[model samples]
Structure formats: structure tokens, C-alpha cells
Target: MKITLEKVHGSMNTFYMVDGEERDDYANLALQLCAKDQGVDGLLVILPSNSAHAKMRVFNRDGSEASMCGNGLRCVARYVCEKEGVDEAVIETMKADLAVRREETLMDGIETYSVQISPVSFQLKDLPMEYDNQTTLIQQAIPEISEEIMFSAVAVPNPHLIGIVPEEIQKSPEHQKKWAEKFNGQNNYFSDGVNVSYVTKVGQGIFVRTYERGVGFTNACGTAMTASALISCMSDMVPFGEVAVYNPGGMVKCTVNKSGDTFELLLTGNATRLSVHEFQWEEEQVDSEFTAFEILDEQRQYEKFIEEISVVVEQFAKRKE
Candidate 1:
């Protein structure tokens, strides 16, 4: 069998997207393609959908399926848009049917996409967190991690535990990794585990580092950033507006709307189609290595886009200073 796949990234969180109609061994394929050596966060299998534009199925590097992925959605939207030549789409995930739009170009070569991450929830049952006597988990201290560190749990159909850390902690890469590791799955607080983000407020923006539940530390975790921004707004850490979210990979802008208990989030960022890999496989050979795959590089253009944005962000930071 011959398989063609697109490798794309949003805010540096990358995935290998393949059509579901082409193959049936997605779980094993995801594990193989998303290996650290392969340099991908996960694999997304795009399936046919009757309820929406298309169905998006996400698999972590560890081959665990996730309910939703904000970053992956942007890439999928871009894929569908470029493939179908449409400006808008509604992609179905396991959790919800998300609305996505191809926004104006952010850079000369990079296309920007905006995705609606909706149906936000803070209830314990939605996150399915093992907690008692609490309907909502908000800035609560889990003694298992520390006596001082407080966490806010929210699910944008994906479970996230966010901690507002000090500037110094967020600034130090070592500290960020340590804390991410501490609470990720090592801690006994969350039984099913959660994507953990350590966020720090910087000027009018915020910097985040996430230890994803199944993927561990990534360049960026879109839903984690959305969850971070939403919690920051709810906690009065950042006012409602265009929230610039800086992750280790790059930055993404999030527009948050909160009316009493209702919350809606819009995430806008680069949807970069880095390359395409074409390979030949046999159905019986699950772990077959593809030594003869073709690589089409779009990474150079993406790097240029990154460079343009980095300069802008630097100047903005300087102005703040």
C-alpha cells in the first residue's frame, strides 16, 4: 500500500495527518510517526463526517487517543481548506464540532487560522477528576504537589490543570521542566492525569509551558494555552482582550469572551504545512520502516515567518520594558 501524509504544525506543536480512508492502522502508525526521533507530537487521522466538514481523530505519541486537540484542529483546518479550497469549515472531534476560519495572512508565506474552542467546562465530572466535595476546581492547592502551588482545572473538552507560577519560575527552563514533571503523571493528585501548564503573566501577555498528559513536554499545547488564558481571565490575571500566549515553540493569540458562566475562546496562530511524506507499506508488516519516503520541505518558509514574528514580539517586549 502507498500512503501519503502531510506534516503540519501550529505554534510548533506538530503532527502527521493522514486520511482515514487510506489506512486502518492509525494507532500503530501514530506511535511510529510521533516518536521523538521522528520529531512529531502526534498523528491525526482525518475521517469522513456527516455532521461536519470532516472528523479529526487525534493520537498521542504514546498512542493514546485524546478527546480534542486545539493545535491539531488548526492544522486539520488548514489541511481541509487547502485541499478543498474553502475559507471556513466545521471540523468534528470526539468532543465537539469546532468552527474554523482561514484568516488573513499573518506573514508573507504563512497562513493564519482561527479556531473556535468552545463548550468550556470547569466541573469536576467533566474533567473526570477524582475529587470529592467540589463541583468546580479553581485555584485550589493540591497538597501532593506543594503547600503553596495552586491549580485551576478546566476542560475545553480536554482536561487541563494550570498553575500560575512566578515570573522567575516561568523564565527558567529548568524550573519549568521540573514542575511539569512533578505534577504530570508523577503526582497522585489527578488519577486520570491532566495536561499541566505553568503560566506567568508578562506585560499584557502570558508565557506558558505545558506537560501534556500523553505527549509530555511539547513545543506548544494549544488547548493548554487556551485553558491558561481562560483561567487567567477568570482569575483577573489578564483582562479580556487579545491575549498573547507565548509558548516555547512560538506564540498564539487568543480572544476570550466570558459572560457570567458562559465562556467562548478563539485561538489564532500559524498553520504551517511543513512537508509531505510518501511511503509504501504492507498491511501485514506493522512496523515496517520506510527508507524510501519523499520529503517536500516547506520548513524554510515557516522559519522565515517565525523570524518575522520574533522581531515583532521583541520590539513589543522592549516597549513594555
Candidate 2:
């Protein structure tokens, strides 16, 4: 089947804008191809399945799907509202319902987007942090780190570990690597690997570098930003309300209620359309390549098929002068 998709890039993440209807049919293909091509940090699909409600699918470059992504949804919202000339769009993902609206203008002189994620859930099981809720979590001194690192567990859609790293560790690669390993260890207190943010106070806003699970160090993580803003509020670093979070990729401003429980994330940045491509498949070739009604593990076969197709695409791109 021939598919149409839009390639959009946000601060540090990339995504594919596709029709919501074709999500289940083509999401895996898009994920594998884009990841292999290094075309994006993730995939955001607007499924045509429910045109009334657009679906956003985020897939890591490694082909693993994520619950939610802030940067990606903002970019996709901008594309749909501004480019497509729509006012409000509802983006449904694996996590929760996201309401995104278009901005009049962006700092980069382009359209901007904002998404309303679910209220930050800190309940131990909800956040899925390894710790039990019986024990209260407060700012504590880390073993090696000199300054205090405020670590908190919050989940908008997926889980995240928002930590305030000392400026010393923020600048030291060795320190960053050390904690990254610590954060990744199963003993780190998270059933599923948690996205850890090493944040520093940089003037008016906090600067962040995040080590995300499944996706490794990314420029900006939307959920991480929301979590950080909430953590900052809880720690009294920033006032309760809208706060600015600066990352290497761009800036995301988030608003939290007085209780620091509900969070509204505004990812103010550019979403540039890089390229668009068509998908074409040779049915006869595919059929001939495999035996009719051959027995094979569906999951394993599909994985191998994706890998092989990616190699072909890469080879073709390299062949271009």
C-alpha cells in the first residue's frame, strides 16, 4: 500500500505525521524505516482510525513505542492546527487524552503548539516508581554528589524521575555517566527503567539534560519537562504556576497548580517539515520472497522483515550521489 506521511522535527525529537486510520496497519513500518534512516528521534502518527480524535504514536528510534512525548505532540499539533488550518485537536495516545491547540506565532516566527497532559500522578503504583508510598519522598543528599538532588516520581502518561543535579555534576561527563548508570540499575527503584533528568538552575529558568529509558539521552523530553516543573515547584525552586525549562534543544514552559499536582505543558518551539515520502510495496516480490502459508513466528518474522527493509532503504540512500 502507498502511504503519505509528513516528516516533522521539534527541538530534539522528530516524528512522522500520518493519517490516524492507517496507524495499526503502518505504524510498525514507519517506526522501523524512520528509526533505521535516523530520520527522527520518534514517530507521531495521527491515525485516521478516529478522525474525530487524532491518535499519536511515539516510537523510539530503537523501534520501541513510548507512552507519550511532549515535544512530539506539540510539533504534531502545530502541523495539524496551523498547516492543516484547524483550531483544536484531540490527540489520543497510549497514555491519555491530550488536548493541543495552535499558537498565533512562535519565537522562531513559526506556528507553535501546546498540549494539556494528564495531571501529574505521584501515587507510587501510578508513577510506577520502586519506592512504596508509605515512605515520604523529600529532598535528600545523594551519596557522591555534594549538592542536594531532589528526586521525585511523576507520571503524566509514562513514568519519569525528575532530579535536580548539582551544577558540578551537570558539567562533568563522568558524573553524568555515573548517575546515568545508577539511574538505569534495576535497584534504582523503578520496575520499568525511568527517565532521569539532570537539571541545573541556569538563571531565570532551569536547564535540563535527560537520560530517557528506551531512548537514551535526548535533547528534550516533554514528560520530563512536566515532571521537572512539578518537582521544582515542590522543592520551592520555582513558584507554583507556569515555569520555564530550558534544554539543549529548546524551551518548554509548564504550568502547575498550587498543589503542584496538575501540570499543563507548553512546548514553545518550531516544528519544521523536513521531507515527505511515499510508501510503495511490490506485492509479487514480497510474496515470492516468502513461501505461501509458511509457518513462522509472526513477531520474529516481522522484526526481521523490518530490519531487512531498513537495510535496503539505507543502502539506497547511500547510493545517491
Candidate 3:
């Protein structure tokens, strides 16, 4: 059947958003569409919702259904708001129906949207990580990961492990991958796998690099960044308010509103639509010619936005050095 798949990204964490009827073959569909050849970080299916403006179902490249995806949620926000002729809407996720709103352009010609990242938890039973009798891990050193670095686990609806590491460990992608593999693989530490992020406090903001569950390492992970920001707040590394979260892909702003033990985060970033593909999709395969009319302007504008942030990134790296 002929269908429209919009390629979208928030902070360069990409996904192919399909506004279609809800179906059961999402696992198989994600595995196929998210393959490396014609792939994205994940697949987003937008279905009509009785409880909210729209429903977002996210499937990672590994065909795992995630509880929430803030990046994907922003894309869905833009798509649904544009379709529904509204500036704000509540989109149903696997965990909750999140509030998303259209915002002023974040940069030159780059459309922006802000979505809520919420219902934070640090309880052990909430995460896939298997830790001892502790109810939560808040900046504790887990010897299995690294004796020196402290880790904090949070379920911002999707399980995440955040570590504020020193220069050496933060710069070491191999170091992050090494431990991420152990926990995501055959290890008792994380029986069901976890999204692991290594963060470094930078001169301008905080830098985060995430090794995601199901998707391995991504250019960015919105929920992971939000979790990391909340961790930064919990650790007093950064104040609990508007925090600039930078990843390898790009940067996003996370406003962490803290009231006692409760936390609410607003994630704002570029919801750039790369292109609209005119293609035919079958039940099992891409059965016909798929023409990609690339959006050069959005790509160019986003590149400029990336160029604008390179200074802060450079300053961060230099300060680390």
C-alpha cells in the first residue's frame, strides 16, 4: 500500500514517523524499516487516540517497544499539531499521555517543538537493572561498572543509567560501550538491559553521550538526556531549572522543574523534517519505487544550527582538557 513516511529528528535523534492506522506488525515493521541500509534510530507509528490528541508507539531498531521517546514525541507533536490545527496537544505514549506544544523556531528555519518528559522514578523495581536491597541508586559507585565513577539509575518511563564521569571516562567511547555491552548483554546487573549515558559537565552546559537499550549507541537519546539532566539536578552538579543538554548529534534544552521529590522536565529541540518519501509499502516489504525528495533547506538550516553549537562543544572539550 502507498503510504507517507515523514523522516524527522529532534536533536538529530531520527525516526520515520508513519501516521497510519494502528496495527500489530510493528515489531516486524520496525526491524525492516530501521535497518541500516534505509534506516533510522527508530520507527514511530502515529495512531488515532480516544484518550488524547494522538497516540505514539515507538519501536527501536532492535524491534523493542520503548515506554517513551521524547525525541519521537516531539516529532509526533509537530505532525499531529499541524494536522489537528492546534498549537498544543496531548499525545499518548506507552507510559503516559504527554503534553506537547509548537514553539517558536529554535533556529533559523528549523521548526521546534517542546514535549513533557515526566513521572521520574528511582526505585529499583522500576528499572531493569538488578541492584541489591537499595530502593534507588543515586550517585552511587557500582563496582561492576567502574569503581571510580558514580552512577544513578532513573526511570523517566524508560529505564536509564546515568553517570557523571571525569574527563578520561567521559571522552572514552570505548569505556562507555564496554560497560553498556556487559549490562545489556549476558550480565546479571541489567537483566533486561538499560540505556546507559556518560555525562560531562561542560563550560557552557552538560555534554551527554548515550548507549541506548535496543538501539546501541545513538547520536542522541531524548529521554536519556532528560534523565541525565535530572541526575545533574539531584547531584547538584547543575541547578534544577533550564539546562542545555548537548549530545554528539546536537543540543536540546531541558527545563527541570523540581518540587520536593517530584520532577517535571520540558524538552525543547528542533523537530526538523528531513523529507517526505513517496513510496509504496507492502505488508512484508518495500515493494515499489521509493522516491526521496530531500528537504535541502531544513538540512542546511539544521547544519547551521549544529555549526552554531560547535563553539560551546569546543569550549566544553577544552575545559575538560
Candidate 4:
């Protein structure tokens, strides 16, 4: 079987966007294609939807399916909107039907999209975290993670454990990988697994480093950044408005909103197309050698935008490279 896929990214969190018309073994495909050689974080499958413009299913490199992925949704939003010749779209995710639209211009020559991340919750039952039988964690010390640093748990429909760390911890990447390894493994914290992020405020903006649940340390995690921004607002780390959330990958704009008891957020960032590939698939195996490839030019523009805005974060991101 022949397969055509578009390589894309949001905040440099890359993915392979494929239509769900061909083979059905997405789990295997993600496991194989998201390897180091393929150089993608996950796979995004666009399936037919009756309730919205399209449906998005995310498969991590570890063959785990997430409830929702903010970055992948942005990429999917742009892809479907452009394919259907529309300016806006309502995409059905695992948890909610999200509204996404093209941004007029976020950066020069970059395609930006804004998407709704909703059904936010702070209850422990939602994240299902087990810690001393606590119901909610709000700027409280979690000794398991750090004896001094405090954490706040939030689920943007996908579980996240965020902590506002000090400058010392923020500069040390090894510390994050250490704790991420502990929580992602069989300890006693997140049983099912959770995305862990250590964030710090930097001149009205915040820099976030994430250890994603199934993807391990990543350049960015869309839901994690959204959760981090919301936690920052609730914890008074940053004002409740448009926050410049910087990650190792790039930066994104987040706005937190609340009405009555409900909370939702808007995540805006670049959805740059990287390249196109033609591959052969048979018996759940994706050919490593592509017959033909078309590398796109949007990445240079995206890198330029990142270079201009990410002086502080870029230094840290370079360590990942």
C-alpha cells in the first residue's frame, strides 16, 4: 500500500498528519514512524466526523492514545481548514469538540491557528492522582516531586502535573528528566501516567519544560503549556491574561477564561508544515526509505520567528538538540 503524509509541527512539536482512509493499524504506525530516525513526536489521524468538520486521533510514540493534544489539534485544524477551503472549523477530539480558526498573522510567513482547550478541571478525581488522599493540589508542597517546590494539578481533559519552580531548578534540565523518569515509572504517583512540567516566570512570561506522559522529554506539550498558564494564573505567578508561555520548542500565547464554575483556555501558536513523504506500507510495517520527499519552506520562517522571540528559551532548547 502507498501512503502519503504531511510532516507538520506546532511549536516544533512535530507530527505526521495522515488521513484515516488507508490502513487501520495506527498504533503500530505511530510506534514505528515516531522513532528517532523518523524524528516525530506522534501521529495525527484525521477521521471522518458527523458532529464537526473532522475528528482527530492522537497516537504517541509509545503507542499510547491521549485524550487530547493541543499541538496536534492546531496542526489538524490548519490541515482540514485548508483542505476544505474554510477559514474556521470545529474539530472533534477525544474529550470535546473544539473550535479552531486561522490567525490573521502571528509571525511573518508563518501559519498560526487558535484552538479552544476546554473542560478544564482541578479535582484530583479528574487527574486521578494519588497523593496522601488529597482531593486537590494548589501551590502545595509535593515531597515526592520536590521537598520544597509546590505543585498544582489540572486536567485540560488530559492530566498534567505542574510546578512553579525556582530559577535554579529551571536551569537544570537533568532535574526534570530525573523526576519525569520517576513519575512515568512505577512509583506511587501517577498510576496511569501524567505529563509533568516545571515552570518558572521570566519577565512577565513563563518558561516551561515538560516530560510528557508517553513521549518523555519533549520540545513542547500543548496541553501542558495550557495547563501551566492556567496554573500560573491561579497561583498568581502571572496575571490572568494573554500569557507568553515558552517551552523548549518555541512559544505560544494562552488566555485563560472563567465563567461561574467553568474554565476554558485559548491556545494560539504556529502550525508550520514541514514536509511531505511518499511511503510504502504492508503488514503493519512502514518503509524507512521514501520513494519521493518534498521538503517544505515554512520551517525557516518558523525558526526565524522562534529566534526573534525565544532568546531565553532558545538557549535551553539548544540543549535538547
Q: Going through the candidates in order, what is the number of backbone clashes in each?
A: 0, 9, 0, 0
What Cα-based lDDT does every candidate model obtain? Answer: 0.79, 0.61, 0.84, 0.86
- Candidates in order, TM-scores: namely 0.89, 0.76, 0.94, 0.95
TM-score, candidate number 3: 0.94
Better of 1 and 3 by TM-score: 3
The pairs that clash in candidate 1 are none
lDDT of 4 by residue, 27-61 (tens): 88778676634568899999999899999999998
- Model 4 clash pairs are none
lDDT, model 3, position 93: 90
1-321: candidate 3 lDDT, tens digit per residue = 667788888877888888889778877767767663344888999998899999999999889999899888998999999998999999999888899998888786988999999778888788856778688898999986688888999999999999899877776689898989888889877778999999999864699989889988887899999999989988889998999998877889999887777788999988888888755666655554465555535878888888888876554332110
Return the top candidate by lDDT.
Answer: 4
Q: In model 3, what lDDT does residue 1 have?
A: 66
Comparing 3 and 4 on TM-score, the stronger one:
4
| lDDT tens digits, residue span 116-206, model 1 | 9977888877876766578888998866555666788888888888888886566555754565566555554565678888888877888
Off by over 4 Å in 3: 36-39, 286-296, 314-321
